[model samples]
Structure formats: C-alpha cells, structure tokens
Target: MPVAIRSGVAEPVWFVLTAIVFLVLLRRGQRRATPAAVLVTGAIVVAGSLLLPFVLPPVADDPGTGGPGIDGAVNPLINLGDDLRQGGDVPALTYTTSSTQGVYLRLATLDKFDGRQWEPADIDPARTHDVAKFPAPTGLTSAVKRRTLKASVQVDDISGRWLPVPYPASRITGVDDDWKWVAGGLTVRSRSTSASGQHYTASFLDLKPDLAQLRAATPSPVGMPLDVSVPTGMPAIIAQTALRVTANATTEYDKAVALQDYFQSDGGFTYSETAPVDQHYDGSGADIIAQFLQKKAGYCVHFSSAMAIMARTLGIPARVVVGFQPGTPASVNDKRVFQVSSHDLHAWPELYFAGIGWLRFEPTPGRGVLPTYSDPQAVDDAINQGGGTASPGATASAGPSSSASDPGGASAAPSASAGAATATDRADATPWIVLIVLLVAIALLFTPAAIRAAQRARRMRAVARGRDPAGNAWAELRDTARDNGWAAPDTQTPREFAERLTVTLASSAARIDGLRRGVETTAYARAPGPIRVEDLRSVVKAIGASTSGRDRVRAVLLPPSLVARVRGDEE
Candidate 1:
C-alpha cells in the first residue's frame, strides 16, 4: 500500500483540542447581563458545543480502530498512560484479586479521518491494506530457549470500557475480543466493564527471531513508510542518522540487527520527557524526528517516532505502537494468584515486512516480555481463528462507579457539604461552580445600592406626607430583623444594646468593639449610606460572631442552600 507514515507532533494537536472542551463548558459564558430566556438558549448551545462530547466520541484525533469500544472515541484520556500522566489520581499500582481486567487502554488507532474528525469504525477495510510494504529491522537470532512470564491487570477508577494488555499478546482467553486472534490481535481490545471487578492471566513468551532463519524465510520490505511531503531539509539529516546506525551492515538482516543493537546499547537508553519548548512545539514533524534521532535519548514515543522517520529515509514502512508490556504480578489472589496494576503501560514499534504482517520490536532501553501461547486449546483456536472472540480475563469491569462509600458506609448522601465539599464534587461542579460565583458577585455589586435608594425615596415620601421618617427607617430595619432571625428591642438606647450584647458574652472584647462602631454609626452619624445597618445587624441579629461560633460551623452541617445553618443563614 501507499506508505501511511505519521509523526508524533500530529497527535498532540488533536489531544489538546479535545481536553479544552472540558474547561470551556465550565463557564456560563458571556450571558451575565442577558435575561433568562436568552441565557437558557445560550447555555444549550454551549452544552452542545462542549458537554455533548462527554456523551459522544471525539471524532477529530482518533482513527477508527474498532467500533469505539465502550471506552468510546476518547480512549486516550481514559487509559492509565494518558489519563494518569496528565493529572488527577496517581493510578493504583497494585492489581489485586478485585481489580479490573479485559480493559484495552488503546493508544492511537485511526480508521478514517474525514477532513475534520475521526470516524472510529467507518473506514473501509479495503483502504487499510497497504499493497507496497517497506523494509524494517528484524534479524534471526538462533537461541531457542523460550522463557515464559505471566502478568495480570486490574482496573479501579477508570471509565470508558476496553481491556488493558501490553502489546504482542500472543494468546488471550478466559475473558471476552467477544475470542478472535487476528495474528496481530496481540493488542488488547474489550468492550465491557465489570461490577465486582476482574482478574486474568497472560503468558509472555521470549523468542529469539534468528536473523539467518528470518532472512532465509522470506525476502521482505522494511516496515517504515514514507511520504513525498517530508520537509526536504530534514530528510537528508534523517538519512545521515540512519546511515550512522546501519553503515557496518552488509545484509538487510544485518542492518535490522544493527539498528536494534544501537537502541539496546547503554548510550541509547535515556528517558526523555523534555522537548525544546519553542522549537519542538512547532509543527515541523520532520524536524522533530531529526532532533530526536540526534539526541538519542527520549521516551518510547520519541524513540518510535524518530525510528519511523529515519526508516522512511531508507524506504521502510514503520509505525509506533503505544500499549503496555506484559505486566509484573500485581498481587497474589485468594487462590494466591498474582495481579498487575495499570503502571505497566508502555510503548514500542511495529515494523512490517512482506508476508509477515507486523513484528514487534522494542527500541526502548529495557526489554518487555511479549505474550506466548502454550495451551493446546490456544493452539487449536489459533489454527481456527475465530471472530473478535479472543479477549482477556473472566471478570469485566462492570460500569464506572456511581458511588464512593465512606469507610463506615453510613455517611449521608452527598448534597454539597454544609461548609466545605468533597474534592470530587468540587471538581465535577467546575462549570456550574464558576458561573454561580460570578452571578452572586454581580448581584452583590448592584443589589446593595439599589435597595438603599428605594429605601431613601420611601422615607422622603413619608416625611412629605407627614409620616414618621425615623419610624419608617426603624420599621424597615425591624422587617429585615425579623427575616434575619433578629428581634430589635421596641425601645432601646445605644447603652442598652451594648449591655444586652455584653450579657451574652462577657469576655467578647473584640466583638464588642464592632458592636460599638455599629451603634455610633446608627444612633449618631447614620443615614444615606446605611452606616447604622451594621450596628442593628449586630444587636437585633447575630453578626460578627467568632468564626468558631454558630455561623462557620453551620455551613458544613446543613450542606445544601435550603438547609438553614443559623436559623436564617440559609439565604
């Protein structure tokens, strides 16, 4: 086929755009001054533009690998690798008997991209098969002492459904691809989640792909693909880099052998997470490839990406595979079985040669165990390849958790804590939370002055008509007092108010100061500015109470706004 080569730079652009939607939908948007009718309409638009994707698959960056497995179109964010790396919970490292299995934390699988978005299962299979295969590094090593390692996986907080397994999984069974092994079906794929959680066993077989045997087995092309559009300048540099690695090799197998040796050598293994911010941040994919090859020290993604580009320079078709390694035993089960956690996630490369679909090659510093099949049942199934029936683990991750029980399991249902809140609800409420805060702020800004002006106008009217202006003001204050759970004394002086407050708390010197200020502002300087409001608020109702007192304690006790804290504090 036409070599469908790609670079890492193209993938992140799509992911960044996908993650931004979560942040944008959080705000109510520019509807502050608008009326309810217009605001509601705008909210709907924003909801569709942002929140809708939470329900639908992200069509932009993904190429259809399968029918959007239950994990749906946004598998990258749900998988432990991308999900945990970005932020949030540090993924649990131990996979116990109760952890999830049969979860495929898919990396990047593109079936079709129709201009603007990914169509995850709609790409016709005919277009996927490449006719012209490129050359890749694979050699024969005649050691036949096969070693086997067993690894299992578990899932806890992760959602969208898919099985999790490292790449090159040779035989998977006892769980549910619902049991089809597609030769290259080594990558994990699952469509369901379990309720009680899951566990599964995977066997990794170590093989020495003998160079002499492989070379004699068939004449093939290197798996690295190419495009005519490589930035012309970087192509030459990429070629030089490739030549440096394989110059001593005379045979294609030897060339492949040299490339592998270069990667495994000590000078080859440096974990690289840092990139030249401004330069690598640019869209020059070729430049990124050349830089990575020159540095010789990057993570698996960088290594695979650089390898692909350099291979293309030598006319090979290659691609990067982001999956997991056959995991280490997570925990011993009740049956004393060992389980694996999510941390085993890994990435590597797949080089395609003629006739041989795609063989796995890990250029990363350490070696990862690839799965092997020893079961007679497994061999029979392999001889008779079924549908997508080849799956992993018997226990599926039921649906995502809808409840997190306290240790006692006796806590009340969450309804926004009376005072502070649980971290989960706080994070979940981000969009609405920001909007509520903004609205409250706007109301406070204008509402305080508006109510005062109306009061002054009423008082002036009362005086002109011969009503008691002072009485009117006191009446307004009394009405507010009743609503606020305060009882203004029918006839009391400033001294009387202070004495009554002192009786409640004889040692409250600080609060007494605030009360004194309120009394002066009310009984002496009062008026047009609502200065005396503070004093009346203190005497008639509870104001400026110590934080340790009733007010601060109440918010956490009542929770939702309707549940009053200090009698009238709910409003």
Candidate 2:
C-alpha cells in the first residue's frame, strides 16, 4: 500500500509527539535507564501519527479511499473496484498520445484467485533492462493492422512501486535504471522508484482485432494454463450466470462478448461508487462475485473482478488489469493530452482468445471505453433492454448512487474543476486508513526492546576501549547472566563471585578464577595488566555450557534482566 501524504496540521502534531517521546526517554535513561516511559511515549507517537490523518480531515494530495489492491506494479494488482467507487475526482496521472483514441496503460494483470480476491502470481525472475523491441505478441501477426503510437506520461501523487506501461510496449525512454521488464504481464516495474513523479515515453503497438477474426479464433489449451483456473467453491450463480448469458453465443469470443453485453447492457446493472446494501461482497475474489451477481450494482472493481472470474469459470484465460483510464482530453502546445485523475483509476477484465491473444473487454459500467469489437446486435439488444451505451462515463450522480436513465451513454466529459478530495471522500478512506495505523502500532510495540539492545551493545563497545578489556568483558558476562535470571549480586567481591561461579558452574571454575584474577590485578595495581580476549570468552562459554539447554535458550531469547530494567521491576 502507498503511504498517502495529505496536507494537514498532522505534521506539527507528529513532530511534537516524537519530541516528547525522545525527551521522556532521555530523562528516564538519566534517572534509572528504565524503558517504560519511553515505550509508552513511543507507542503514543506511532498510534497518534496513524490516526491524525483521519482525525484532521483529508487535505490536498489526499489519497482517496483505497479500494482493495492497487499498487504501482505492472502486473498482479488487485481489489481496485472499491477504490474506483470510493475515489473523488483526484488527479491520477496524465498522458499525451500520438493517436486520437485514449490509451489505457496497464499497471498489473491479476491471475491468481484466492477465493477472496484476485492477485498476481509469481513472475519470472529473469528481468530485461532494455525496453526496445519486446517479445512479440503471442499470436498477433502482419495480417492485423497494428497501430504504432508514442505516449509521454507524467505521474502525479499516485503511490506504488510499479510503473504503468501499455501492453506490448516496444520501447521506453527516460526511465530510471532500476526499472525492469516483467515478462508474464509485459509491464515495466521499478525496483525502488515509485509510480509517483515518474516521467517517461513509451512506444507501443496496438493490434486492433476485427470482430470476425476474434469470433473465429479458437481456444488453445496451452494458453489456458495461465489464468483459467477457477476455485471449486466459487458461487454456483457465477457459473450459472456465465452459462445462461452466453447460451446463445457459440464462439469463445462471442461468449466473452455476450458476458460483456450482459453486464454492461441487457443486465440492468447500474454504475455506482457504493456497493449495494443487501449484497455484502465488498472484499474481492469468488465471494464478492457472488454478491455482485445478486446486487448487480458496484464500481469498476466489482465489475472487472466478476467478469474476469466469470471468464475463467467459462474456461477462458482471463485476468484483471489495474490502471488509469485514458483521461479527459486537454490541449497543451497544440497537442492533445489525456488528464487521468484519481477518479479515473480503474480495473477491467481481459480474456485471451487463441490466435488473437489477449483482448480487453469493458464490463465496467460508466467507467471505461467500450471495446471496438463488441457484437453490434447484442449491444443494441442491451440498449433496447434498458442497458446504457458503452461509454465509460455514463450520466450518473458523481457520488455513490447509480442512474439508469442513460446506460450505454456517451463518456462523461472530465470536468476542469475536479481536483481536491472533498470531506465526504476523506471520510470514505477512514477504515483502510485506520488499518494502516494498527499495523504501525504493532511494529512500534517492539521499539523499547530494540533500543535497550542497541544501548547495551554501545556500552559493551565503550567498555572494550579501556586498558582492562578482560575485566570489562567479565563484567559484561556477569550482567548478561544477571539479565538472564542468573545470580550477579553487587555485594559479592570479584574473588567471591569467582568462587561462587566455580561452585555453581563447576566446568568453568578455572576460567572464572582467571577472569577474577585479571579484574583484581586491574583494580589493585597502579599499572593494569595486559588483557587477553580468550579469558573472557573461556569463562562465558563455560557458564553457558554449564546451564541446561532450556535455560541457555531462554537466556538468549528472553532477556529477563532487560525486561526488569525497562519495567523498573528489578529482582
């Protein structure tokens, strides 16, 4: 998940809390080196930082309500339907294309279905640095009229580590060296740089398959191995719906076209940002599809996930694509550019047909461009049956509810004024935002122990710098024993402690006496004796060797002395 930086007074609040924790820790360390105050104060800082975003209300650069799974990856992005529904008209990214048609740059292709949501499968580790002349499309050939286009993209505040690139990109320029080509999805991703602030130009070839050619294409069994696996426990309604909808269609392409028409047209489903009340499938995967089937109302995530799952259920290899829709057109330097906003963030289903390879479908209502090859008769039938036009932006309220007055309507023109997230939009992002906070809290809980270990290491290093390294090493070992529930009383003299060690740990008696003699010589003599490193290790090893296996393990893992010091509950 991307860390959203919203402009608010939360920054000042964060600084104040951090300062308080540091000051409290410093004061406590000076007194008794207790970590209780530090731990409590640090926990507060972590929790407060997480909650402040929600409490302060979203400001500029606010990442609108995240749907489910959207990252910066070029493949395997999932759970974006909810974000599509919940987002306000925030800017996502902008692009300038050589062609008149809007270009849909893909983020990731999610193929793995874990019953709850769709995710990307493991990709080949072999990465290509060069983006010039990628592997050719599997089945596309010279017969198809391939349109070559150059597109320059500029990312705004979008988060995630993946770079967005069009399918079958031939060349890319101006990308950082960290970017790598992932073969399975044919998308580019960065090893470090995020999608935000990315500026690059991509050269891609778009093969527009004719409706007839797609319809005639057969299903290849080999290609089906990628994304055609459907979970066994998938709702029966999904399979039944796919069967029922495509019953009249004969070819694989037509079956796909039929499913598209069923969802976008004849199905009477409306485009809305909110999920239906009676249907509770807000999460992803098979269960969400079941709820989507019954409700028939959701944003793009629901529609895309459902269609992809349905295609797989019908034995067609399908995957969901997460990316920005070709945004609204704008003129810059007399060239046309598409301004994709956060609201333009979308997900759609793509199905693979043999010979034609993978082709995209627009099942998401009022959200994406309709594919060029949808069956004309079926599309008209859908329109006649109260299904709207194939336009991505249908005329509906700009919020959560849907409007059926104009389905299959023309794409809604992007508004010039659409910018910052509203109060309502900020409110929608609250739950997921809180989840991020809780994760931070879990990480912060171990802060005190980590700090104490670091301090002990520093102290040990400082002690080693003195003339009596052996004596200091002995003292460290004694403290270690004390922390791990062994006896290391301050009242015992060095010789007395050595005698006690000989009795308690019989095997280490000679080494313990040697260490004690060194300590006594360093303390009593004006000129300290030279230190031997092995004397300290010899005694420490003997002590460890004498303890039971369970006690030795406990001493290393659960340092009772450190815990007692932190709690100011020394025993």
Candidate 3:
C-alpha cells in the first residue's frame, strides 16, 4: 500500500479482527462469549494501533508544516479574506496612548503590483537601516506640522516577523529582537525574530498637514521611484477611471482626494467581505481592480488596492499598507487600553506628496477614520463659514459620510442639522427597544413554568368542586415526580410507584401510601368514600420538597413533564 493508504489502514484491520473473533467464538459452542471476545479484540486492536506511528519511520516531507510562516511573504488580499473569515474576535495586540485620535499600527507595505497580486517591495540593503535609531522621515519638511506621541504596545496573540509600529516612528525601545527599519516607509521588521511576545514603546511623529499645505504640494518621485511606477500590461480601466474621476481636480492633493472619495463614497461602492470572493476577483491584481470598479462592492482590500493603483496611474506615488485599525477601548489593571484583534486587520492606501512624504488616505468605507485634511469638502466648508482652515489638531471623523453628503459642492449645513436630529432620535429610542426585547425574552423563558402552574391550579379547583379528587391528586403527584426527574414507567402500578418513592421521601412515605390507597379505591371501589383534597395537595408538596435545589429550579423554569406530555410520552 502507498504511505497515504497505509497510514489509515488500522481501522479496517481492527474491524476484520473483531468480526473474526465473533465468528470463532460462536462456532466453538461459546455463543455467550462472542460479545465479550469481540469487545476485547477491538480494545486490543485500538491499543496496538496507537503505537503504529511510533514504530513507523517518519516521512521526509510532512504536509502539516507547509503553511504561511512568520515574516514570510504573504498576499495582502488573501490575508484580508482569512482575517474576515475568522469566527471569533481574537486579540492580536493592545496599546495605551494618551492621544485621543485613533492609531494605525502598520505592519507591512505592498508596493509591488505584478498584475496578479500585490507584494512587499524588495528590501534594498541601502534603504534598510538598523533599528537602534531611526533616521528622519523621508521627504517630510517643516511645512507639514507634526507632533511627537508615545505609545506602549503589548503583543498578545499575533505572530509575524514584521513589528506593528505607528508610521513615521522616530525611535522604538524595549523590544528584545534585533529589528531593522526600512527608511522610505519607516516599517520595522526582523530577519529571524517573531513578534509573538513583545512589549515595546514607540515614539512617532503624528503628522497633521493643513488643507492649504497639501493642496500646494506637488507629487515628487525623487526618492520613491518604485511607488510611482505602474507595471506594464496592466488593466486599462484603472488608469481610465482615475483620469475620469479626477478630471475636475487640478493639484496632486485634489486628485488624490478625488480618488479616495470615488471608492469611499461617490462610486456607489458598498463594503462586503465576501463579494469579491463570490465574484471570482478576490485579489489586488490589476484585473481584480478593473472588476472591482465594475462590481462596486468589496471589503478594505479591494477598496485600498483600487485606490492605490488608480493613484499610481495618475503619476502619484502610492502603496497598500496592511495593519490594524484603531481597536475597541477597554480597561485592564485600572489602566485604559485599546485592544486590537484579528478582526481589525485592515489595508489602506498611502499617497505621497513632495513636502508631506507619504500621506495616509482612507478609501475604505465604514472601516477607519477619514482624516479631516483629506476631506476637501469639510476643509472648504470650515473656511467658507469664517472658521478658517481646519485646525491641525482637529479630530478626524469616521465613515464615508464624514465629509459632504452632496458631492456637487453644495453647503452641507442643512443635511448635517437633519442628520444630527435623526441620530438623537435613535439614541433616545435605543433603551426602550432593549427593554421591550428583554421583557419579551423573559416571558418566553418562563412560558413552560407558567403553563405548568396554571394546569396545577385548574386541577386544584376541580378537586375542590368534588370532581374526582383522588384521581386528580394522583395525576398531580406523578407530574410532580416527573418534573423533578423522577419518572415512573406506565407499567408500574400506583402502589408500586409509591413504594419506590418511600426510599427518597422517607419522611412523607405514610402520606404517599395513603394517596396511593385513595387512588386505588377510587378506581376499583363502586361506592368509594370521599377523599380530602388537602391530603392530595400535601402529598404533591412532599415529593417537590424531597428534590435537590438544582432540580427544584429546573422544574420551576423548564419542567421536563410539560415537554414529555406534549410529545405524547406520558399518559
């Protein structure tokens, strides 16, 4: 047999041995020994099979070890699919920062697009520098205002060769690995170490360029030659769409903003993690972008890649950055923390300007924050209303609707006022909706108990009216026992059932015996004496009290007797 078949052959051999043992025992006039002999044979076979792996020599190429490795090259589009398909929110890392703005911890950059998929750029030795100290950010001039912010990060469950750091980091300390920095992007990575158990502090420059500065900036390829270049034989729709979307824009910043708006808001695009996969274009390839533009529905990978590729077509330096978005806020050890999870894995585009270097642009709808400066409409509205240009410290808003709802350059004040009112209405109604849902759930949870209580009450009323008191009491006693998980079979007589209950309900044995006698006399005797309804009630109570606490609660909340009666399992 081939190794594949041989490895799984134990089960068939064990079945054959068990069958042979049963036949041998039966033929030798030992019919009673067949079951035991077969069982013994199966046990021995299973025990022996457990040793087969240890006895057999190992195979050279084990298929189990061939998965994505830490620090190994991975396709960002495929990684996004895997992350979205995950069933649970698994924590990847956590960080604490004083800044109120959301933090984007970039892990890697995919600048190389080969018409099939996007990959990390080839690491040039000259551009890669030691991580002991970082050089000044590339192409960042004094015109763009920036402030230093410190964040303490703790890695929890993620494993990768690339370290998650805030972009444009000035310095990082407390990492045990010998990490290195790629100068142009300022991304950190290690050649051998994994980011499995790391606690590090990073000091990064939080660049906040005003709208005026970005508009005046020009697209420069002085150092980032690769970021600006699009591969040959690429899809024509990429460039064509870019030209059409930004046809009204003049500057590089305006063109970049237009591209972001097209994908994020204006293009009729909706975010769906599974749409691209179902449509057979789930990749960051040139062809994938062309299809994505037509379909107009995909997750962050499609949105970011389309924007990045479109920007490159317009002679702007662009790349796709893979990392985590700002995570949910939590508290640990009485300290505030932002916990990032596998579900937070995201991809966004970075477009470069001459003086501003690489500026982050959010082209994915409903995922990350849309920077205030990137929203040209918001900036223009502020200036028109005598508020001046948006402040550098102004907080960015989230979602595609963060900017103007009207793309034709209309005043957004009326729409903003209406939206605020609708939001307030929803906020006020939320608690009432929750309360109604909770009340309905509680009612449904105790429906069985309520029905059972009503049935008992009806039976007590009938007994009080002298309508077969002994028969009603007997039925109630049996139901009470069944609800507490002490059921009596149909074959058992009332006397036999009462005798069995005498052991557990020793203190109430006399009451149980009297009830059983009353039921027998009522069924058999033609002129039976009247039985007191009080004696029947006392007997049912005794049986209920004899049960354990857990059984008592279960009987009240979800009695098994009701279910059994509904299924016609009880008389």
Candidate with maximal TM-score: 2
How does model 3 fare in lDDT? 0.65
Q: Which sequence of candidate numbers ranks them by TM-score, best first?
A: 2, 3, 1
- By TM-score, how accurate is candidate 2? 0.56
Per-residue lDDT value at 121 in model 3: 65
**Runs in model 3 with CA error above 4 Å?**
1-77, 123-128, 221-224, 377-571
Candidate 2 wrong stretches, greater than 4 Å: 1-88, 123-125, 223-225, 276-279, 376-571
Specify the poorest-scoring 10-residue window by lDDT in model 3: 409-418
> Against the hidden true structure, what lDDT does model 1 obtain?
0.35
TM-score of each: 0.40, 0.56, 0.55
lDDT for residue 62 in candidate 2, whole number 0-100? 19
- Residues 1-571 of candidate 3 have per-residue lDDT tens digits of 2322223223434444554576566547543333333334434443333334335763321112222322212323344555666677667788887455447777777776655556666433243476657887767888766567777898776555667788778889997446777656677776656676679988777666666878988887555555457889987888999999999999999998898788766888888877876776666667667888999988777787788788888988777777777676677999878877777777778877777777777778877666656766566554444332233433324432222111111100000001111222233343454345345445555667889999898888877887887777777778888888896777789888999888888887777778788788888888654566776788778778878788998787767677666545544
CA-lDDT, candidates in order? 0.35, 0.60, 0.65
> Candidate 2 on 298-328: residue-level lDDT in tens?
7676777788778877888777667666667
Q: Write model 1 residue lDDT over 1-571, tens digit each, in one string.
A: 0001211112322433433454346434543322222333333443333334334543422322233122222223222223213433333223322222222222333221111111122111222222121111123122422233344545433333334442333344355423222112233333333311334554433332323333443323444232212235554666786788888866544454456556656245555434422234211145444565666655444454455445445544444444333333333444433322334344444444443334444455543421112111332342233211121221112211101101110010100000011111222344564355345434433443345446545754663454543444444444333333344455765456556556755665445455455435555664522333333334333422423454433322222222222123422
Q: Give the winner by lDDT.
A: 3
